[model samples]
Target: MDKLTVPTMAELAAKGESPEILFWVGCAGSFDERAQKITRDICKILQHVGIKFAVLGTEESCTGDPAKRAGNEFLFQMQAMSNIQVLDGYNIKKIVTGCPHCFNTLRNEYPGLGGNYEVIHHSQLIQQLIDESKLKAEGGESFKGKKITFHDPCYLGRANNVYEAPRKALEILDADLVEMKRCKSNGLCCGAGGAQMFKEPEKGKKDINIERIDEALALNPNIVASSCPFCMTMLSDGVKNYNKEQEVKVLDIAEITARANGL
Candidate 1:
């Protein structure tokens, strides 16, 4: 892949220019090896569509989703306040996040603390691009005649009611879109939400992620598409447990979009 040119908020500000949107690279997108690929794909899509965007870079901090979910309200607020200070200083008005955890917190939870902004998940932005005919699915042949099943991130689907955007993005590829029994509002959790990812699972007949993957495998999809980093980790691990990693591949929506457009 060619090197990508992404600007930091400070760099753009120094030039007396402000980006139209802030690309919020959540903790996973910044540090997790697998998720960093999604981060780059998102940047490629933004640049391909000629959208002006900037990242906070080191100025970006965790959205405190884990802390809040772990019931550490005090720590969550401290981190949130610090981020709000930096974002407000930059005069950021619109944000597109790679992680649904960040999307939920920054969009829903922050406003109560006097930090309000137009926050959207990358899936929504991708849908918008496709709708405006900017992303014409020029390389959609990559996914043509393939079977795909999308795993809805809990925060993106149930919590925020963003069900159509991601499917619309996939629909443009002309692939056979299959739906799991527990999709849409009834989507199952990948067992990584609510701070569960940081600890061992409690006693159960089966892990939640395994069960979720079982549902997807039932459809025999070529690609298990997701829009969240946490879900990506869990689903990929589940596929490994069933010894089906070779046959089934896990991918993010942004990655699929970037690849389809040859970005």
Candidate 2:
């Protein structure tokens, strides 16, 4: 991976003269091309509706979630302090992050480390935009051709109580939506959260995500959509490993919305 370094929030504030919003694209979304595209699409939609936001780019470093979860308090404190200094410099009080891990860390954990900000997940912002009529899907061009299901990220759903925005977004697309036997607050981990993204999972009976893929496929859905980049990456790998290509797809909620809007 590239060296993990980020701008202090002050440096970012200096760059944007007067930024209207701080867009926090987490490590996964920043490193993964597909995730980046979805993030860009969301930014476009927000911009179309006059939401002035500044992309933090490489300046928004890891939220230290992996370190903290791994019990490496030293590394976690270093990362957290660096990020706090950056945020303090920028005078940023509000942040929008695409990754639920980042969202949870910033919103819930940061205050203890002297970083306080109002953090909102991308899904929440998208739902708001749609509700205000700033974002709309074209009517009738439903994913009538395929069936799909949504996977709830633990941080976004159980930890933060944000279970409906993403599902609502999918419902608008008119896709054949099915619920996983374990969903919403009861959703299973894709084996990618809680810093699982940075480490190898212990060998087990089966991969958590693969099990999820099987469940989604059991419903015969052509696509499995989710809000978290980590979940998307894991589930996509699960589908590929299972040799379910051509039979199913994995998509981010923003990508689904973009398609529904005919963008």
Candidate 3:
């Protein structure tokens, strides 16, 4: 793995420098082992493209998405307000995040609490980079002609109308892009949204993640691409449940992008 350097907003501020954008490392991206790879890859992309970016580091907090989703409004507000205060103190005007939960909460829910910033998902940022020619998709990459199915994150897709960004990012790879029966506006959840991820499922007909993975498996995809860390966990668990981990790999969009770019 290549070493990565992520500047903290505090460090940049002390130097009388302001980053063009703030990289919000959501809870998963910061602490989840699997998600950490995606975090590093996004950092690699931003650094490679010469984007002046900084992270809040210890000043960052959970976006209160899970608390809000789990029906804890008071806790959610408290968390949101604390984060908003720190962001406002730093005068953060733009933010890019790897998790849709953070993106949705910051982009939509934060303005009400006085945290107004331009928020973008990593996928959208990658798409913009590609469009700007800061990133290029060259031939002969590892995924060329391999089948891949995209699992849309709820916050990124229907909740925010971001169906095109991840798809556009995936297009940079040399792969066969396939869609499950339920995708885009009609995509299925991986049984991890709305705080379901923290609690065991109630007795149900089937695990949502398994049911959704079944749809992906039905297409015989070589890779299951996801943009959210939560979705990645659930979908990867679904693949393991079916004992198909060897045949199929669950990957985040950032991981795929970094690999394609040889980062």
Order of models, best TM-score first? 1, 3, 2
Q: Could you tell me the lDDT of residue 161 within candidate 1?
A: 100
| Runs of candidate 1 exceeding 4 Å displacement | none
Task: Assess candidate 1 and give its lDDT.
Answer: 0.95
Q: Pick the candidate with the highest TM-score.
A: 1
Global fold similarity of model 1 (TM-score): 0.98
How close is every model to the real structure, measured as TM-score?
0.98, 0.90, 0.97
Can you write out model 2's per-residue Cα lDDT over 150-212, one digit (the tens) per residue? 999999999999999988787767668899899988898888887788777898998888888
lDDT comparison, 1 vs 3, better candidate: 1
Pairs with backbone N, CA or C atoms under 3 Å apart (clashes), candidate 2: 8-86, 9-86, 9-87, 9-90, 10-89, 10-90
Poorest lDDT segment (10 consecutive residues) of candidate 2: 1-10
> What's the true lDDT of residue 68 in model 3?
98
Per-residue lDDT of model 3, residues 1-263, tens digit only: 35678999999999999999999999999999999999999999898788999999999999999999988999999999999989998899999999999999999999998889999999999989989988876522588898999999999999999998899878878689999989999999888999898899999888999899999999999999999999999999999999999999999988888888788
**Least lDDT summed over 10 consecutive residues: which range in candidate 3?**
135-144
**Stretch of 10 with least lDDT, candidate 1:** 136-145
